[model samples]
Target: MSRASRLLTLLQMLRGKSRPVTAATLASELEVSERTLYRDIAELTALGAPIYGEAGIGYVLRSGLFLPPLMLNADETEAVVLGLRYVDQRGDEELSKAAADAMAKIAAVLAPRPRTHCAIRPCCPARRATASPTTRCRSMCSARRSAFRPRC
Candidate 1:
């Protein structure tokens, strides 16, 4: 993958976890050297991706920031779908529908053609975990909106 693509992958990986990810893991996943990963991270930071971390710990993207449409890639698209699916499975009827609705809205807003096809059915096996899918969906919806529409 290109540097830009690698950087986008890094962002997507960070989005999946609720915790910081180590540079080593990122490098291994992206098939890059640790030094290359660090440079890529620096490049993303310079571009104002809300990456947060320090040496030996890891890095995280701040949850509430809105990312530009141009920054999202194919893997990121799948990440979004997976996240929404998890939320949908755990949510109450209202919230579950809301998650589906949010996905629809995202599909509607996507740029025409190939970008639009990024919307796909998430096939995550429904989890039996006792957590609030409603809350997760709400938070994701809020964060997605924040990424697009700036705060006043």
Candidate 2:
């Protein structure tokens, strides 16, 4: 991957994760050396990726008034694909179609770009789940709104 692409991936890694991520962990995830990961993170911060961290303390994305769309590294892309696949399998017809359409949209938006690109479909088997799509969607929407206005 190009330097810019790697930096974008690093941003995504920092964003997706709920906790701080060490350079070594990032390197292992991105399949790059620790030095390279540091360089990439430095460049990402320079590019306004909001990656925050220190030596020995891993990185964490700081919350703000605006939360940008989390960019996807290759692994994240695969994980999303896999998750969507599971959702599609377990969800109803309409929900499954929606999930597939969303994934397609994500690919279209990210493809033909210089960033981390992933096209292969994930093969992980999806186990059954009991949550209804409407319930899940409503809960997610509510959570998002609440997160943005937690003090209210």
Best by TM-score: 1
Candidate 1's C-alpha lDDT? Answer: 0.66
Worst 10 residues of 1 by lDDT: 143-152
- Residue-level lDDT of model 2, residues 1-152, one tens digit each, is 88768776666666456579888999998999998887887776676656779889898765441243446765566556656765676789999877776664465345343123323433334222777887766765554333233131
lDDT values, one for every candidate: 0.66, 0.62
Cand. 1 TM to true fold: 0.47
lDDT of 2 at 124: 35
lDDT of residue 127 for candidate 2: 29
- Give each model's clash number: 1, 1
